[model samples]
Target: MDPRPPDETPGPGQQPKPPFDRERFIFKTLAVVIGTQLLIYSLAAGVCGQRALVGRPVGQICPGTLEQLQGGFDSTLKLLLALLGGAALTRMAPPS
Candidate 1:
């Protein structure tokens, strides 16, 4: 017969291990990054009168806001594409 209880938990000052592993962490990170970028782009597009569904026909944005939003969108897109391309290249590389 065992002396210890079957449902033992961590002792004081000890931390429990996370439920998710490395793959889950990576997936969550990617999801958050991509989701955030998409949200920002959508909001900016709506604000700048560029989104097809929610945007107004006449321009309602401030003079510099539209340009700034476009520039930010372009930069973010380039960065995301570069990161995805690099990851794909690494994945496709043969083991050395």
Candidate 2:
């Protein structure tokens, strides 16, 4: 008789590993990345707009703000394209 609890040990023929889920993992990672990008861009837009809203002189604007905003937009676009590509690949994959 084994001293360990039954549930604590794997029985013969009982593989404890769960099945690998590639599709679900990829989609979830993409969702998190896209959400992060969206948040960055939204904050950048707000900061850029604030300077203009308060009647600040044009020269007072931070030069890096525009660049950062543009970079954020570009990154977000790439992430969206990646998601679309993933979806396309999944569709083209052979049915299990």
On a 0 to 1 TM-score scale, where does candidate 1 land against the true structure?
A: 0.45
- What is the TM-score of each predicted model, taking all chains together? 0.45, 0.53
Query: Model 1, range 7-87, lDDT digits (tens) per residue?
Result: 758899989877766545765676687677678767765655554456545445544665675676677667767867887
- Which 10-residue window in model 2 sums to the lowest lDDT? 57-66
Query: Mind giving the per-residue lDDT tens digits that candidate 2 earns over 1-96?
Result: 998766756789988887788877977887787677778767766766786699875463555766776786687678768877988999999999
* Predicted candidate 1, C-alpha RMSD: 8.4
Clashes of 1: 0
